[model samples]
Target: MLDFLKPPVLTIQEFFILAGRTIRSIPRRPHYLNDLLMQMDIIGVGSLPIVLLTGFFSGVVMGLQMSRALQTYGAVSQTGPIVAITLVREMGPVLTAVAAAGRNSSGIASELGSMKVTEQIDAMRALGTDPILKLVKPRFLATSFMLPCLTAIADFVGMIGGYIIAIGLLHLTSAEYWNGAYRALEYDDLAQGLIKPFIFGMVVSLVGCFYGLRTTGGTQGVGRATTQAVVVAIVWIFALNALITKIFVSR
Candidate 1:
Protein backbone atom coordinates (compact mmCIF):
# COMPACT_ATOMS: atom_id res chain seq x y z
CA MET A 1 0.00 0.00 0.00
CA LEU A 2 2.65 2.49 1.03
CA ASP A 3 4.82 1.15 -1.78
CA PHE A 4 2.09 2.02 -4.26
CA LEU A 5 2.18 5.58 -3.02
CA LYS A 6 5.89 6.02 -3.68
CA PRO A 7 6.84 9.28 -5.37
CA PRO A 8 6.79 9.41 -9.16
CA VAL A 9 10.35 10.78 -9.02
CA LEU A 10 11.60 7.25 -8.45
CA THR A 11 10.19 6.25 -11.83
CA ILE A 12 12.36 8.79 -13.61
CA GLN A 13 15.41 7.67 -11.65
CA GLU A 14 14.74 4.04 -12.49
CA PHE A 15 14.39 4.89 -16.16
CA PHE A 16 17.71 6.67 -16.21
CA ILE A 17 19.40 3.77 -14.41
CA LEU A 18 18.05 1.27 -16.90
CA ALA A 19 19.03 3.50 -19.82
CA GLY A 20 22.54 3.86 -18.45
CA ARG A 21 22.93 0.13 -18.09
CA THR A 22 21.66 -0.42 -21.61
CA ILE A 23 24.07 2.15 -23.01
CA ARG A 24 27.00 0.74 -21.08
CA SER A 25 26.33 -2.72 -22.44
CA ILE A 26 26.76 -1.54 -26.05
CA PRO A 27 30.57 -1.47 -26.13
CA ARG A 28 31.08 -4.93 -24.69
CA ARG A 29 29.51 -6.92 -27.55
CA PRO A 30 30.40 -5.44 -30.93
CA HIS A 31 29.15 -8.39 -32.93
CA TYR A 32 25.67 -7.04 -32.33
CA LEU A 33 26.35 -4.66 -35.19
CA ASN A 34 26.44 -7.52 -37.66
CA ASP A 35 23.21 -8.91 -36.32
CA LEU A 36 21.74 -5.42 -36.56
CA LEU A 37 22.63 -5.15 -40.24
CA MET A 38 20.90 -8.45 -40.93
CA GLN A 39 17.82 -7.22 -39.16
CA MET A 40 17.87 -4.06 -41.28
CA ASP A 41 17.78 -6.22 -44.37
CA ILE A 42 14.93 -8.23 -42.98
CA ILE A 43 12.91 -5.30 -41.71
CA GLY A 44 13.74 -2.68 -44.33
CA VAL A 45 14.54 -4.48 -47.52
CA GLY A 46 11.96 -7.18 -47.08
CA SER A 47 9.33 -4.62 -46.21
CA LEU A 48 9.79 -2.79 -49.50
CA PRO A 49 7.23 -4.73 -51.52
CA ILE A 50 4.38 -4.09 -49.13
CA VAL A 51 5.36 -0.48 -48.61
CA LEU A 52 5.52 0.11 -52.33
CA LEU A 53 2.19 -1.56 -52.95
CA THR A 54 0.45 0.37 -50.22
CA GLY A 55 2.04 3.68 -51.20
CA PHE A 56 1.07 3.18 -54.80
CA PHE A 57 -2.53 2.50 -53.91
CA SER A 58 -2.68 5.39 -51.50
CA GLY A 59 -1.38 7.75 -54.16
CA VAL A 60 -3.86 6.45 -56.68
CA VAL A 61 -6.69 6.98 -54.27
CA MET A 62 -5.53 10.48 -53.40
CA GLY A 63 -5.28 11.46 -57.03
CA LEU A 64 -8.71 10.07 -57.81
CA GLN A 65 -10.31 11.81 -54.87
CA MET A 66 -8.54 15.09 -55.49
CA SER A 67 -9.35 14.96 -59.16
CA ARG A 68 -13.02 14.55 -58.43
CA ALA A 69 -13.01 17.28 -55.82
CA LEU A 70 -10.95 19.78 -57.79
CA GLN A 71 -12.58 19.38 -61.21
CA THR A 72 -15.23 21.91 -60.20
CA TYR A 73 -12.50 24.47 -59.61
CA GLY A 74 -10.82 23.60 -62.90
CA ALA A 75 -7.79 22.73 -60.79
CA VAL A 76 -7.60 19.05 -61.72
CA SER A 77 -4.03 19.59 -62.89
CA GLN A 78 -3.00 20.32 -59.29
CA THR A 79 -3.73 16.70 -58.30
CA GLY A 80 -0.23 15.44 -58.95
CA PRO A 81 1.50 18.14 -56.94
CA ILE A 82 -0.99 17.81 -54.07
CA VAL A 83 -0.54 14.07 -53.99
CA ALA A 84 3.23 14.39 -54.08
CA ILE A 85 3.31 16.97 -51.31
CA THR A 86 1.00 14.94 -49.06
CA LEU A 87 2.96 11.75 -49.62
CA VAL A 88 6.39 13.29 -49.13
CA ARG A 89 5.42 15.60 -46.28
CA GLU A 90 3.10 13.35 -44.30
CA MET A 91 1.68 10.05 -45.48
CA GLY A 92 4.86 8.22 -46.42
CA PRO A 93 6.63 8.42 -43.08
CA VAL A 94 3.44 8.03 -41.07
CA LEU A 95 2.29 4.94 -42.93
CA THR A 96 5.72 3.37 -42.91
CA ALA A 97 6.04 3.88 -39.16
CA VAL A 98 2.60 2.40 -38.56
CA ALA A 99 3.46 -0.63 -40.64
CA ALA A 100 6.78 -1.08 -38.88
CA ALA A 101 5.20 -0.73 -35.47
CA GLY A 102 2.72 -3.42 -36.32
CA ARG A 103 5.19 -5.79 -37.95
CA ASN A 104 8.68 -5.27 -36.50
CA SER A 105 7.72 -4.14 -33.01
CA SER A 106 5.39 -7.07 -32.53
CA GLY A 107 7.99 -9.50 -33.85
CA ILE A 108 10.73 -8.12 -31.63
CA ALA A 109 8.53 -8.27 -28.56
CA SER A 110 7.34 -11.79 -29.29
CA GLU A 111 10.81 -13.11 -30.00
CA LEU A 112 12.38 -11.53 -26.96
CA GLY A 113 9.46 -12.50 -24.74
CA SER A 114 9.84 -16.07 -25.86
CA MET A 115 13.53 -15.94 -25.07
CA LYS A 116 12.78 -14.55 -21.63
CA VAL A 117 10.19 -17.25 -20.98
CA THR A 118 12.56 -20.01 -22.04
CA GLU A 119 15.30 -18.62 -19.76
CA GLN A 120 17.49 -18.06 -22.81
CA ILE A 121 18.12 -14.49 -21.73
CA ASP A 122 19.18 -15.82 -18.33
CA ALA A 123 21.42 -18.32 -20.04
CA MET A 124 23.03 -15.56 -22.03
CA ARG A 125 23.65 -13.58 -18.86
CA ALA A 126 25.21 -16.62 -17.24
CA LEU A 127 27.46 -16.95 -20.28
CA GLY A 128 28.71 -13.41 -19.58
CA THR A 129 26.82 -11.93 -22.49
CA ASP A 130 25.11 -8.60 -22.07
CA PRO A 131 21.58 -8.94 -23.48
CA ILE A 132 21.23 -5.24 -24.17
CA LEU A 133 24.35 -5.20 -26.33
CA LYS A 134 23.65 -8.50 -28.03
CA LEU A 135 19.88 -8.18 -28.40
CA VAL A 136 18.60 -4.66 -27.87
CA LYS A 137 21.42 -2.74 -29.56
CA PRO A 138 21.14 -4.70 -32.79
CA ARG A 139 17.39 -4.12 -33.01
CA PHE A 140 17.78 -0.44 -32.15
CA LEU A 141 20.44 0.09 -34.77
CA ALA A 142 18.56 -1.88 -37.39
CA THR A 143 15.30 0.02 -36.86
CA SER A 144 17.06 3.39 -36.96
CA PHE A 145 18.78 2.60 -40.23
CA MET A 146 15.84 0.94 -41.93
CA LEU A 147 13.05 3.40 -41.13
CA PRO A 148 14.45 6.32 -43.14
CA CYS A 149 15.11 4.07 -46.09
CA LEU A 150 11.60 2.67 -45.94
CA THR A 151 10.07 6.12 -45.77
CA ALA A 152 12.06 7.21 -48.79
CA ILE A 153 10.89 4.22 -50.76
CA ALA A 154 7.30 4.79 -49.72
CA ASP A 155 7.46 8.40 -50.80
CA PHE A 156 8.84 7.49 -54.20
CA VAL A 157 6.32 4.74 -54.79
CA GLY A 158 3.44 6.93 -53.68
CA MET A 159 4.48 9.60 -56.14
CA ILE A 160 4.61 7.03 -58.90
CA GLY A 161 1.11 5.89 -58.03
CA GLY A 162 -0.14 9.44 -58.25
CA TYR A 163 1.56 9.78 -61.61
CA ILE A 164 -0.08 6.64 -62.99
CA ILE A 165 -3.55 7.52 -61.79
CA ALA A 166 -3.25 11.11 -62.91
CA ILE A 167 -2.09 10.18 -66.37
CA GLY A 168 -4.06 7.04 -67.03
CA LEU A 169 -7.34 7.22 -65.18
CA LEU A 170 -7.86 10.98 -64.99
CA HIS A 171 -6.95 11.60 -68.64
CA LEU A 172 -4.33 14.14 -67.63
CA THR A 173 -1.19 14.41 -69.71
CA SER A 174 1.80 12.59 -68.26
CA ALA A 175 3.98 15.59 -68.92
CA GLU A 176 1.65 17.90 -66.99
CA TYR A 177 1.48 15.57 -64.02
CA TRP A 178 5.23 15.09 -63.95
CA ASN A 179 5.86 18.80 -64.24
CA GLY A 180 3.59 19.73 -61.33
CA ALA A 181 5.00 16.94 -59.17
CA TYR A 182 8.59 17.95 -59.90
CA ARG A 183 7.92 21.61 -59.17
CA ALA A 184 6.01 21.00 -55.93
CA LEU A 185 8.24 18.31 -54.47
CA GLU A 186 10.60 20.54 -52.51
CA TYR A 187 13.70 19.33 -50.67
CA ASP A 188 12.30 20.68 -47.41
CA ASP A 189 9.21 18.55 -47.76
CA LEU A 190 11.25 15.40 -48.25
CA ALA A 191 13.56 16.26 -45.36
CA GLN A 192 10.66 16.96 -43.03
CA GLY A 193 9.06 13.62 -43.82
CA LEU A 194 12.33 11.73 -43.53
CA ILE A 195 13.16 13.12 -40.11
CA LYS A 196 10.12 11.67 -38.33
CA PRO A 197 10.83 8.06 -39.28
CA PHE A 198 14.10 7.97 -37.35
CA ILE A 199 12.35 8.99 -34.17
CA PHE A 200 9.53 6.56 -34.83
CA GLY A 201 12.03 3.76 -35.39
CA MET A 202 13.74 4.49 -32.11
CA VAL A 203 10.44 4.53 -30.27
CA VAL A 204 9.30 1.26 -31.79
CA SER A 205 12.52 -0.58 -31.06
CA LEU A 206 12.93 0.80 -27.53
CA VAL A 207 9.37 0.10 -26.46
CA GLY A 208 9.47 -3.39 -27.92
CA CYS A 209 12.78 -4.22 -26.26
CA PHE A 210 11.75 -2.62 -22.98
CA TYR A 211 8.53 -4.61 -22.73
CA GLY A 212 10.32 -7.81 -23.73
CA LEU A 213 13.03 -7.26 -21.15
CA ARG A 214 10.44 -6.69 -18.46
CA THR A 215 8.50 -9.84 -19.31
CA THR A 216 7.80 -12.28 -16.46
CA GLY A 217 5.50 -15.12 -15.31
CA GLY A 218 6.46 -17.45 -18.11
CA THR A 219 4.30 -17.79 -21.27
CA GLN A 220 1.32 -15.65 -20.31
CA GLY A 221 3.57 -12.80 -19.28
CA VAL A 222 5.46 -13.06 -22.54
CA GLY A 223 2.23 -12.85 -24.53
CA ARG A 224 1.10 -9.88 -22.54
CA ALA A 225 4.42 -8.16 -23.02
CA THR A 226 4.32 -8.66 -26.77
CA THR A 227 0.77 -7.29 -26.99
CA GLN A 228 1.60 -4.33 -24.80
CA ALA A 229 4.71 -3.56 -26.82
CA VAL A 230 2.73 -3.39 -30.05
CA VAL A 231 0.00 -1.26 -28.56
CA VAL A 232 2.38 1.17 -26.91
CA ALA A 233 4.63 1.42 -29.96
CA ILE A 234 1.68 2.24 -32.21
CA VAL A 235 0.20 4.82 -29.85
CA TRP A 236 3.54 6.52 -29.34
CA ILE A 237 4.34 6.52 -33.04
CA PHE A 238 1.06 8.20 -33.97
CA ALA A 239 1.31 10.70 -31.15
CA LEU A 240 4.88 11.56 -32.08
CA ASN A 241 3.89 11.93 -35.70
CA ALA A 242 1.21 14.43 -34.76
CA LEU A 243 3.65 16.36 -32.58
CA ILE A 244 6.27 16.46 -35.30
CA THR A 245 3.75 17.53 -37.88
CA LYS A 246 2.56 20.32 -35.62
CA ILE A 247 6.11 21.50 -35.14
CA PHE A 248 6.88 21.52 -38.85
CA VAL A 249 3.56 22.69 -40.17
CA SER A 250 2.95 25.30 -37.53
CA ARG A 251 6.26 26.86 -38.32
Candidate 2:
Protein backbone atom coordinates (compact mmCIF):
# COMPACT_ATOMS: atom_id res chain seq x y z
CA MET A 1 0.00 0.00 0.00
CA LEU A 2 2.80 2.39 0.82
CA ASP A 3 4.50 1.54 -2.46
CA PHE A 4 1.31 2.40 -4.31
CA LEU A 5 0.84 5.62 -2.36
CA LYS A 6 4.44 6.67 -2.82
CA PRO A 7 4.34 6.76 -6.64
CA PRO A 8 1.61 9.40 -6.62
CA VAL A 9 3.88 11.77 -4.71
CA LEU A 10 7.23 10.46 -5.83
CA THR A 11 6.38 10.61 -9.50
CA ILE A 12 5.31 14.25 -9.25
CA GLN A 13 8.52 15.17 -7.53
CA GLU A 14 10.66 13.25 -9.98
CA PHE A 15 8.88 14.84 -12.91
CA PHE A 16 9.47 18.40 -11.64
CA ILE A 17 13.11 17.69 -10.82
CA LEU A 18 13.58 16.35 -14.31
CA ALA A 19 11.88 19.42 -15.77
CA GLY A 20 14.02 21.83 -13.75
CA ARG A 21 17.22 20.10 -14.82
CA THR A 22 16.22 19.96 -18.46
CA ILE A 23 15.22 23.64 -18.45
CA ARG A 24 18.49 24.66 -16.83
CA SER A 25 20.49 22.79 -19.45
CA ILE A 26 18.95 24.83 -22.24
CA PRO A 27 21.22 27.93 -22.09
CA ARG A 28 24.34 25.83 -21.49
CA ARG A 29 26.86 24.70 -24.04
CA PRO A 30 26.05 21.99 -26.63
CA HIS A 31 22.54 23.10 -27.46
CA TYR A 32 20.58 20.64 -29.58
CA LEU A 33 19.31 23.03 -32.28
CA ASN A 34 19.09 20.36 -34.98
CA ASP A 35 17.23 17.96 -32.76
CA LEU A 36 14.92 20.71 -31.56
CA LEU A 37 14.09 21.65 -35.16
CA MET A 38 13.39 18.04 -36.07
CA GLN A 39 11.08 17.67 -33.11
CA MET A 40 9.32 20.90 -34.08
CA ASP A 41 8.70 19.67 -37.61
CA ILE A 42 7.21 16.50 -36.27
CA ILE A 43 5.17 18.02 -33.46
CA GLY A 44 4.05 21.20 -35.21
CA VAL A 45 3.79 20.61 -38.95
CA GLY A 46 2.63 17.05 -38.52
CA SER A 47 -0.23 18.16 -36.30
CA LEU A 48 -1.62 20.86 -38.62
CA PRO A 49 -4.32 18.86 -40.37
CA ILE A 50 -5.85 17.49 -37.21
CA VAL A 51 -5.82 20.88 -35.56
CA LEU A 52 -7.46 22.51 -38.56
CA LEU A 53 -10.18 19.89 -38.75
CA THR A 54 -10.82 20.12 -35.03
CA GLY A 55 -11.11 23.91 -35.17
CA PHE A 56 -13.43 23.91 -38.14
CA PHE A 57 -15.82 21.39 -36.69
CA SER A 58 -15.76 22.84 -33.21
CA GLY A 59 -16.53 26.32 -34.53
CA VAL A 60 -19.33 25.04 -36.72
CA VAL A 61 -20.92 23.26 -33.82
CA MET A 62 -20.49 26.17 -31.50
CA GLY A 63 -21.96 28.58 -34.03
CA LEU A 64 -24.90 26.30 -34.67
CA GLN A 65 -25.64 25.75 -31.02
CA MET A 66 -25.17 29.34 -30.07
CA SER A 67 -27.34 30.43 -32.96
CA ARG A 68 -30.23 28.45 -31.57
CA ALA A 69 -29.77 29.79 -28.07
CA LEU A 70 -29.37 33.37 -29.18
CA GLN A 71 -32.30 33.21 -31.62
CA THR A 72 -34.62 32.92 -28.66
CA TYR A 73 -33.89 36.58 -28.02
CA GLY A 74 -33.39 37.60 -31.67
CA ALA A 75 -29.66 37.92 -31.01
CA VAL A 76 -28.40 35.70 -33.81
CA SER A 77 -25.74 38.23 -34.91
CA GLN A 78 -24.06 37.64 -31.56
CA THR A 79 -23.12 34.09 -32.65
CA GLY A 80 -19.80 35.26 -34.02
CA PRO A 81 -18.69 36.85 -30.80
CA ILE A 82 -19.93 33.91 -28.76
CA VAL A 83 -18.18 31.32 -30.92
CA ALA A 84 -15.03 33.42 -31.10
CA ILE A 85 -14.90 33.90 -27.35
CA THR A 86 -15.54 30.24 -26.67
CA LEU A 87 -12.91 29.01 -29.09
CA VAL A 88 -10.33 31.64 -28.30
CA ARG A 89 -10.72 31.66 -24.53
CA GLU A 90 -11.35 28.01 -23.79
CA MET A 91 -12.31 25.42 -26.37
CA GLY A 92 -9.58 25.94 -28.95
CA PRO A 93 -6.63 25.70 -26.59
CA VAL A 94 -8.17 22.91 -24.56
CA LEU A 95 -9.19 20.91 -27.60
CA THR A 96 -5.84 21.41 -29.29
CA ALA A 97 -4.16 20.14 -26.15
CA VAL A 98 -6.53 17.18 -26.07
CA ALA A 99 -5.77 16.26 -29.67
CA ALA A 100 -2.06 16.67 -29.06
CA ALA A 101 -2.23 14.61 -25.90
CA GLY A 102 -3.97 11.86 -27.81
CA ARG A 103 -1.51 11.96 -30.66
CA ASN A 104 1.85 13.43 -29.63
CA SER A 105 1.77 12.60 -25.94
CA SER A 106 1.03 8.93 -26.54
CA GLY A 107 3.58 8.86 -29.32
CA ILE A 108 6.21 10.39 -27.06
CA ALA A 109 5.54 7.91 -24.29
CA SER A 110 5.52 4.95 -26.64
CA GLU A 111 8.66 6.07 -28.44
CA LEU A 112 10.56 6.64 -25.20
CA GLY A 113 9.19 3.45 -23.72
CA SER A 114 10.37 1.43 -26.71
CA MET A 115 13.78 3.07 -26.51
CA LYS A 116 13.95 2.16 -22.83
CA VAL A 117 12.96 -1.45 -23.51
CA THR A 118 15.51 -1.76 -26.30
CA GLU A 119 18.27 -0.54 -23.94
CA GLN A 120 19.10 2.25 -26.36
CA ILE A 121 18.58 4.79 -23.63
CA ASP A 122 21.17 2.95 -21.57
CA ALA A 123 23.59 3.16 -24.48
CA MET A 124 23.24 6.92 -24.50
CA ARG A 125 23.90 7.04 -20.76
CA ALA A 126 27.04 4.96 -21.26
CA LEU A 127 28.24 7.54 -23.77
CA GLY A 128 28.16 10.23 -21.03
CA THR A 129 25.19 11.99 -22.61
CA ASP A 130 22.11 13.10 -20.66
CA PRO A 131 19.03 11.44 -22.11
CA ILE A 132 16.76 14.13 -20.79
CA LEU A 133 18.72 16.80 -22.64
CA LYS A 134 19.13 14.79 -25.82
CA LEU A 135 15.59 13.51 -25.87
CA VAL A 136 13.20 15.23 -23.49
CA LYS A 137 14.42 18.77 -24.13
CA PRO A 138 13.76 18.64 -27.84
CA ARG A 139 10.28 17.29 -27.31
CA PHE A 140 9.64 19.71 -24.50
CA LEU A 141 10.65 22.72 -26.57
CA ALA A 142 8.76 21.50 -29.60
CA THR A 143 5.51 20.94 -27.74
CA SER A 144 5.84 24.16 -25.79
CA PHE A 145 5.98 26.26 -28.95
CA MET A 146 4.18 24.14 -31.53
CA LEU A 147 1.11 23.57 -29.41
CA PRO A 148 0.43 27.32 -29.30
CA CYS A 149 0.98 27.56 -33.02
CA LEU A 150 -1.40 24.68 -33.55
CA THR A 151 -3.92 26.31 -31.25
CA ALA A 152 -3.62 29.52 -33.24
CA ILE A 153 -4.28 27.68 -36.46
CA ALA A 154 -7.21 25.94 -34.88
CA ASP A 155 -8.59 29.20 -33.56
CA PHE A 156 -8.46 30.78 -37.01
CA VAL A 157 -10.03 27.77 -38.67
CA GLY A 158 -12.72 27.60 -36.01
CA MET A 159 -13.58 31.23 -36.60
CA ILE A 160 -14.02 30.48 -40.27
CA GLY A 161 -16.32 27.63 -39.39
CA GLY A 162 -18.27 29.97 -37.19
CA TYR A 163 -18.46 32.43 -40.05
CA ILE A 164 -19.90 29.79 -42.35
CA ILE A 165 -22.57 28.89 -39.87
CA ALA A 166 -23.33 32.40 -38.70
CA ILE A 167 -23.40 34.17 -42.04
CA GLY A 168 -24.27 31.42 -44.47
CA LEU A 169 -26.72 29.39 -42.47
CA LEU A 170 -28.29 31.93 -40.19
CA HIS A 171 -28.49 34.71 -42.80
CA LEU A 172 -26.78 37.11 -40.42
CA THR A 173 -24.79 39.84 -42.12
CA SER A 174 -21.07 39.09 -42.38
CA ALA A 175 -20.08 42.56 -41.25
CA GLU A 176 -22.23 42.35 -38.17
CA TYR A 177 -20.94 38.96 -37.12
CA TRP A 178 -17.29 39.78 -37.69
CA ASN A 179 -17.62 43.19 -36.10
CA GLY A 180 -19.20 41.70 -33.02
CA ALA A 181 -16.39 39.13 -32.87
CA TYR A 182 -13.78 41.86 -33.07
CA ARG A 183 -15.55 43.94 -30.48
CA ALA A 184 -16.05 41.09 -28.00
CA LEU A 185 -12.42 39.87 -28.26
CA GLU A 186 -10.28 42.13 -26.10
CA TYR A 187 -6.52 42.12 -25.85
CA ASP A 188 -6.61 40.35 -22.52
CA ASP A 189 -8.93 37.65 -23.86
CA LEU A 190 -6.77 37.06 -26.91
CA ALA A 191 -3.64 37.12 -24.82
CA GLN A 192 -5.08 34.52 -22.52
CA GLY A 193 -5.95 32.31 -25.47
CA LEU A 194 -2.41 32.58 -26.75
CA ILE A 195 -0.93 31.81 -23.36
CA LYS A 196 -3.05 28.81 -22.40
CA PRO A 197 -1.86 26.49 -25.16
CA PHE A 198 1.79 27.21 -24.47
CA ILE A 199 1.29 26.21 -20.87
CA PHE A 200 -0.71 23.15 -21.92
CA GLY A 201 1.96 22.21 -24.43
CA MET A 202 4.57 22.06 -21.71
CA VAL A 203 2.21 20.09 -19.54
CA VAL A 204 1.63 17.47 -22.24
CA SER A 205 5.29 17.06 -23.12
CA LEU A 206 6.44 16.99 -19.50
CA VAL A 207 3.86 14.46 -18.45
CA GLY A 208 4.65 12.34 -21.49
CA CYS A 209 8.39 12.44 -20.88
CA PHE A 210 7.95 11.87 -17.17
CA TYR A 211 5.79 8.77 -17.50
CA GLY A 212 7.84 7.54 -20.42
CA LEU A 213 11.11 7.67 -18.47
CA ARG A 214 9.56 5.62 -15.70
CA THR A 215 8.62 2.70 -17.94
CA THR A 216 9.35 -0.82 -16.74
CA GLY A 217 7.83 -4.30 -17.11
CA GLY A 218 8.72 -4.60 -20.78
CA THR A 219 6.03 -3.70 -23.36
CA GLN A 220 3.25 -3.70 -20.78
CA GLY A 221 4.83 -0.87 -18.86
CA VAL A 222 5.18 1.16 -22.02
CA GLY A 223 1.51 0.79 -22.78
CA ARG A 224 0.64 1.69 -19.24
CA ALA A 225 2.77 4.80 -19.36
CA THR A 226 1.29 5.91 -22.67
CA THR A 227 -2.25 5.55 -21.33
CA GLN A 228 -1.45 7.16 -18.02
CA ALA A 229 0.32 10.05 -19.70
CA VAL A 230 -2.75 10.87 -21.75
CA VAL A 231 -5.15 10.56 -18.84
CA VAL A 232 -3.01 12.48 -16.39
CA ALA A 233 -2.12 15.21 -18.87
CA ILE A 234 -5.76 15.73 -19.80
CA VAL A 235 -6.85 15.92 -16.19
CA TRP A 236 -4.15 18.47 -15.51
CA ILE A 237 -5.20 20.48 -18.54
CA PHE A 238 -8.74 20.94 -17.19
CA ALA A 239 -7.52 21.55 -13.69
CA LEU A 240 -5.11 24.18 -14.87
CA ASN A 241 -7.80 25.69 -17.04
CA ALA A 242 -10.03 26.06 -13.99
CA LEU A 243 -7.31 27.75 -11.99
CA ILE A 244 -6.36 30.03 -14.86
CA THR A 245 -9.96 30.89 -15.53
CA LYS A 246 -10.51 31.82 -11.91
CA ILE A 247 -7.57 34.19 -12.12
CA PHE A 248 -8.87 35.74 -15.31
CA VAL A 249 -12.41 36.11 -14.01
CA SER A 250 -11.48 37.58 -10.66
CA ARG A 251 -9.66 40.42 -12.34
Best by TM-score: 2
- Of the candidates shown, which would achieve the greatest lDDT relative to the real structure? 2
Count of residue pairs whose backbone atoms collide, per candidate? 0, 0
lDDT for 221 in candidate 2 is 92
lDDT, candidate 2, 92-181, per-residue tens: 999999999998889899999888988989999999888988999999999999998999899989999999998788998889888988
lDDT of candidates 1 onward, in order: 0.83, 0.91
Per residue, candidate 1 scores C-alpha lDDT tens digits across 125-221 of: 9998878888888888788789989998888888888888888878889888889988998878877888899888887887788778778888899
RMSD of 1: 2.7
